[model samples]
Target chain A: MPDSEGHPDFDELELGAVLTALADPIRRQVVAVLAGEPDGTERPCSSFGLPLTKSTLTYHFRLLRESGLVRQVNRGNSRMAQLRRADLEARFPGLLALVVAETQQAGKGAPSVAGNTARAPH
Target chain B: MPDSEGHPDFDELELGAVLTALADPIRRQVVAVLAGEPDGTERPCSSFGLPLTKSTLTYHFRLLRESGLVRQVNRGNSRMAQLRRADLEARFPGLLALVVAETQQAGKGAPSVAGNTARAPH
Candidate 1:
């Protein structure tokens, strides 16, 4: 049985972290795929098909998991990921809807480039 | 007349930039205040009461403007800021709502700290 040992609790999920994690195009693409799946569906790490190296993909998955956006569990020799849809909806309602909507929009030929590169103000 | 010269067009507003801009707590607070105000209500930059230095605040405002989350225009001696609610709603539905909701939730005594500091995967 997979235990939720490393996942942040629902209350521990911060808005900034969630937003930051979802800000990446690749992470958002991963989230979009997860959002399309049925509830409680667990996908192997290799199932994402992201155009990146294995190490880069691993990093993205770790960020998503740490941000409380997705839950990852070790299954046999591979890692499985699942979007914490219910937890996210309970904490930040309508957030996933926007991600899914944006993904759909991008899929309809909208460019997914980050046009604005405003530096973070310290 | 306030011309939208520096602001990105609705189509040019990228999800990553918008999310990156909103990921900062200070910027999100500014957006939350604007969301609470009436439609088309423009407030001077000094009205936000943020703890950041003047330069830092200005940077945040500029980032928000560049990201298409807020519009800043010079009104006489002061720079006034307004939430581009309509534009955001049209571009990414439920996005501003999530910001507003998160703000409200934070205001309800939740700690608004960015607990998850997972580095951005490049």
Candidate 2:
């Protein structure tokens, strides 16, 4: 229900900052949660199953909102978060999907190889 | 033709470390160059047009090689660098091409909008 930040200006955020914000797997997981849900579906920060404390969860959401990676709005006792996919792709083509796809790739429902460097081209 | 680092091994790198290494735009450009070249082509580090001191350039390539993002082999006066695409994808699917594609997407032949954030979602 509270507006983003002391001043929520979506136009001024930078892509690098957003990418850096999402670089953390926890934050990426949060974004994936929003990405998986429909645009107006409000999911509380607690829904992501991240083990961080509430303050940390708030910080993560703040970073995502400031990075323009998500749009957050207060809705009664809980806040609703939505992925700003259109806004992101418009500014940086193919970035949002690539990152989203990366999260899914990283979470391959199976066990992972110990280490992987670039193996597939194209 | 100098071998990578004081030693060379491909199996010991970490994905997060590799991602952190490629997070820099300049380093990403270097990866782009190697990605565009044929597997065996030997383009010297000087070929990338980055305006950094030799030591810094050496550092970047070293990071790339050690991260398993590229394989460097002694080939006469210059070292040949090739993307270890197969190795990367096997370990982390959809990362290399996504990054390479991101580089190409970033270097738009056309001018970029002053700013763009997610505006599209699939």
Give the clashing residue pairs of candidate 1, or none. Answer: none
lDDT of 2 by residue, B41-94 (tens): 456666666779989988988888877887877656666566786677666565
The clash number for model 1 is: 0
Give the proportion of true interface contacts each model preserves, from 0 to 1.
Answer: 0.72, 0.00
> Across residues A18-61, which tens digit of lDDT does each residue of candidate 1 receive?
99888888898888878877787777667765678899888888
Whose DockQ is greatest here? 1
Q: How does chain A of candidate 1 score by TM-score against the true chain A?
A: 0.83
Query: What are the DockQ scores of the candidates, in order?
Result: 0.51, 0.10
Q: How high is each candidate's TM-score?
A: 0.83, 0.62
lDDT of 1 by residue, B36-80 (tens): 889899998788776557898788888999999888888889888
- Superposition error at B88 for model 2 (Å): 7.2
Q: Highest TM-score: which candidate?
A: 1
